[model samples]
Target: MTGYDDKPWLAAYPPGRPPHLRRAFSTALDMFDAAVRSAPDAAAIHYFDRSLRWAEVDRAAEAVASLLIARGFAPGDRLALCLQNNPAFVVGLVAAWKAGGTAVSLSPMSTEADLARSFAAFTPSALLVLDDLYVDRIRPILDTGDTGVAVVVTTSGLDGQTEDDPRIFADVDRRRPADTVDLAALVDAHLPGPGVLAALAQRRVGPSDVAVLAATSGTTGPAKGAQLTHANLAFSAQVYLDWSGLAPGEPVLGLAPVFHVTGLVGGVCLAMIAASPLVLTHRFEPAVIAAAAARRRPVFCAAVITAYIALADSPDVDAADLASLRLRYSGGAPIDPDVADRLEERLGGYIHNIYGQTETTSPSHAVPPGTRAPIDPDSGVLSVGVPVFDTVVRVIDDDGADLPVGEIGELVTTGPQVIPGYWHDPVATADAFIGGALRTGDVGFMDADGWFYVVDRKKDQINAAGYKVWPSEVERLLAGHPDVEEAAVIGIPDEYRGETVKAFVVPRPGSTLDVDAVIAYCRANLTAYKYPREVEMVAALPRTATGKVLRRALR
Candidate 1:
């Protein structure tokens, strides 16, 4: 019955591990500048057959900041970016922060309608989209005149790529959008100029200022923006950097997408904090990750469970490619214990499980490196692990009272890394956060040993391929079809993804609507991960006493 302030997990720390982190840096930009000054000539970023040193990255970020300012993006403005894991993503992220603006990350897989919804909600002043995606994705949204964006910058996936690389990049002249300017050409047009360096020095970002606006779904339906401050990003990065035990100029693998919080904090921000070189890949292909591991021999990497499964199942991976791996991290989705055991056997390293939300900025609970998690005797659930430095976790009941150990209840957390509130959504912010602690909608309990285990999810959200998919959002889209009378969506257990989206639809009387047509209609409006892969046609949807669809019964 003791409070978590006792920090019982400190007893489980590896020998000589510090109890907490000092968190020396004030902001993410400050950390980045310190890394550049400490190792100007050291490699900071690595792509196919090419590398960018710390000095080069700093100069490029400065030039991009100047371009943003000249394009009418003032301090505290929102800059939307739609890109994958590449050099351009990092460049744009740092540039926006340097210009004292908040960066908004959008999924590259989002359809035109999906993009339009987000753009209208956030009302970003500027946009940075991939060159090839601009034509099919951005142009349609811009034509509607819904977004407030006035300036658009298109970046090539092949910029700074080696000539020997295998991927095909579009020719800038023939395929480039007529209204947008090339990112590389803009940088070349502005860099090494007097104004660029002066602007970089003049703009000042504070620790409490909002640095990033990450999009996340709630139970209500559409995605809401989580306003993360500079201190939130800085502390999260420093916490993991100390946890990984990597040194300056070390090699780290960046396989996760930079847009997500895990990759943004663990992959990019952690590398900057440690002054390490991040080996980048455009997407998660087993062969490419295997080849990069063989060449770079990275010391650490983070990804979802499916990615680890793909690498372990691939024929190209072997002991040599993973020999240098000291620690591995898995987040966004739950990892089966058997899968973790098998992957550890292959890589000779423990795969730690991290638990957090987009609102937490990345991780709040993580298994200490080199240690294995214990299984609960009664529930048979594997513990996610103990809280990291300066974090407190408690299980609360319906009345906000602390529950005893082994009791299932809502998980609440408080720490420096937690975001203050949701962007422009006071109702959601007030509903989710209570007394400075985030009321995480996860039903879990803590053990006497201070370890935490997730028993179930309180929110009716689906984790498909490590992305949160709200059932209500899909139901709204499904109800729009003429042939559909009513719809209900639920998550079904999946082996590869933790869960897959499944829809139960009621066809209009005397109207013929198959599963294919329903899925196609959803695919045209929703993002790739949010679409329902399996559809069931029923005579009518099950209703409750009040005439509401019973999602639990459908499940």
Candidate 2:
């Protein structure tokens, strides 16, 4: 069997496409600068009813850098962004990088407890938040002194959307807080002062500087931050753009959430680096996406399997709506072979399967554009394609030795795009990454022809709605219920969600706990995607001789 150490996948690349990146940028900032210099007046972002040119985005980011510097934020400090797929999200991140601060991307769906935990862990000096959506959650966290957040910049979700958009809802005062600054006002403020510009010029970022604190579930439990350097983000964007053959000024759909790695790197960073226009909307509705695709004629889009399924099932989607699409890619979750075929049959284009974790930045493996993924003859599993430019994938045994091709073992990756390590957790960093390679905890194999296939996952994590749900966190929450004596959670096959959490519970002695009660209890304590959707009650949970729960038996 041919080994992958030589990157055999290069042979399978599309005609005329190089197997490696020919052009390089030292950092993502450099890439953005190049795009702005190349096309100052080109359309950079297309929001609901408003469009922002490259000049506008650049000036706004500079103002944000000035604001951060004026607030005493120094290099290496962390700035958290807790918004959705809005222009503010991009501006804030770029500004943070410009001011030499590491930006942290947080999901807008984070609960009060979730925000508090992250704030305590990262100790961000400032936050850019959606005013109407998360004011309450942020207020309490700030009051507790756990997050160390001194500055807060709030923006309305309707900043660029048409006034009649249904997604916009007002829950709190839109007025700026007495202490916090308004993002819109900052952007409209005069250009950077002499002092702020001086500070900005003095702050220099390099390829090795930490650029983002991407959140991910560690090997065993709770979410930990991954320290992705500027080089990691820059490499991911350049590789994706080059491999997809996306031309500058082409339109790409902004369907993925900005908080997710796929959106941050693939959608925003790729669009900026390619000098392409990113068409954006507030939410992911099938009808809306179809309408936008028909109107704007986007050439590329990357989304999860569920989004593709939704588009296929929607009545508004037809041949003309998808005619503009040159390429479509699926990430965040695995798509079944049958489902993938069904999508292609209905959507008129093949959906290439891309694989990566937050720890690997955004994408390490993707099928080359215009190429169909091959299926494993023995297992009938669809291949996840090949490693992108400059990436190395290896299947290894438990002892960290390379396994022969076609043998299923853990998949480890090493490349410029991989994050340096987990934030502030040396133990986790040591356990998850070894000798510059990340143990992906996925059991997969590569064929002699350089095609890769996934068999199963070694980690106890669920991908509900493309969100990582650690079983242990849910199990711990269930065990805290008054009626639950013990609980074991496992991921079950789900047609819509890829995988949903199912709990096997044992009731406390003399206590009555029904399935509905267990579900409701968990729904109250956990987030929507993290809660167990199905529950099973048993007399006692199966345990090993050492009194440990046998999760496999539960499954």
lDDT of 2 by residue, 218-278 (tens): 3245779999899899989888788888988889888777777888888898998889888
Model 1 clash pairs are none
List residue ranges in candidate 2 displaced over 4 A.
167-178, 193-195, 217-220, 460-555
Candidate lDDT values, in order? 0.80, 0.81
Looking at model 2, which ten-residue stretch has the lowest summed lDDT? Answer: 164-173
| CA RMSD, predictions in order | 10.0, 9.7
TM-score each candidate.
Answer: 0.82, 0.82
Compose the digit string of candidate 1's lDDT tens values, residues 418-516. 899998999999998887799988788898899998765666778887897767567756766888866889999988888999999999888889999
Best by lDDT: 2
- Please give the distance, in angstroms, between residue 427's alpha carbon in candidate 2 and its true position after superposition: 0.7
Backbone clashes, candidate 2:
0
